[model samples]
Target: MGNDNDIRHGRHCVFLMHVHLVFVTKYRREVFTKEIIDDLRDIFASVCSDFEAELVEFDGEDDHVHLLVNYPPKVAVSTLVNSLKGVSSRMIRKKSYPSIRRKLWGGALWSPSYFAGSCGGAPIELIRQYIEQQQTPH
Candidate 1:
């Protein structure tokens, strides 16, 4: 079930938002081992904190990762994605993981394209119907 109390309070607003994010490796390389994935999960969590967001869930295959995040309205999604990719790339590469560095040529960890979608909320149709029923001034 979706969270009934997902609402969050900020200094000037209240909101509840969740996003599903996916990042694929460069050239779809199968580079991540179990240890690397674990490191990535930790890195993502730390990065989320910097943006006042929460990483609710994370999982992935060898070539990509899926992250569930709860973020505030004030945060730009693009900035978050960029930070996650850039920081994690640097950190992972710094570790000098031979397998990852070898497969990931061009010094890029993730492909430029990524997937992001809103999740765990009311259906769009329901919101549309509710809006249609509302009274408006002439």
Candidate 2:
């Protein structure tokens, strides 16, 4: 059964916003290893925490990664993506991970563009029908 409390409660607003994000490596280079993926998971979790968001799930191959995040309404998706990429790139570089650096030429872990899609509880058509059922003026 689905959890009734899936919707998050903030001080002044309640929301259940989620975004599916996909980030590819620069030039589609295969740079990930088991250790690097582990580090990336931790880094992503930390970054999500900093933005009051939850990293619901994360997984990746050598060239790209996917993240499903539940974020508050106040946080912009772009800002979160930028921070995630920026912070992770910086942190990874600070370490001695030659595998990543050797493959990536520029000083970037992720490509310039990414994919973000919204996830919500109800379908738009269902919501539209529900809206149509609302009582109107006599």
Candidate 3:
């Protein structure tokens, strides 16, 4: 009842991909201040939204950040990493923390590389529930 191309395609499958990403500061300088961390949270959320992804969980100390994200199939992992790194670096240099500029020596806020791992079959919903339960009231 359908054409050859249509028949070959079968049903459309939605891919639910969860990735845990870790990004470190250049030379591990520990440059993230509380103010910078707050700003980074906002920026990361906005960027993830643009890419049709959800920033499920995010936290960082001064040197590194951990992000759990749910990404759509159309997006490339490298593209998301590059965008986040590049934009956050520029923003950190320009506004949030000028001290980082001195430390980076005109290079970058984040290291050249990142770590990404799949959360496949890892019960992400349960993890989310645990994180939510741990949240403290302000």
Prediction-by-prediction clash tally: 0, 0, 0
- The TM-scores, one per candidate, come to 0.94, 0.92, 0.75
Listing every candidate in turn, what is its Cα RMSD in Å to the true structure after a full C-alpha superposition? 1.5, 1.7, 13.1
Scored against the true structure, residue 124 in model 3 reaches a CA lDDT of 71
After best superposition, candidate 2 residue 16: deviation in angstroms? 0.7
The TM-score leader among the candidates is 1
lDDT of 3 by residue, 1-138 (tens): 223322222146545577899999989997888888888888898889999788888989989999998788778999999998888888777783666866777657888989999875447787788888995979
Global lDDT scores for all candidate models: 0.93, 0.90, 0.81
Residue-wise C-alpha lDDT for candidate 1, range 8-104, written one tens digit per residue: 8899997889999999999999999999999999999999999999999999999999999999999999999999999999999999998887887
| TM match of model 2 to true structure | 0.92
Clashes of 3: 0
**What TM-score should be assigned to candidate 1?**
0.94
Judging by lDDT, tell me the better candidate of 1 and 2. Answer: 1
Candidates ranked by lDDT: 1, 2, 3
Deviation from native of the Cα of residue 18 in model 1, angstroms? 0.8
Ranking by TM-score: 1, 2, 3
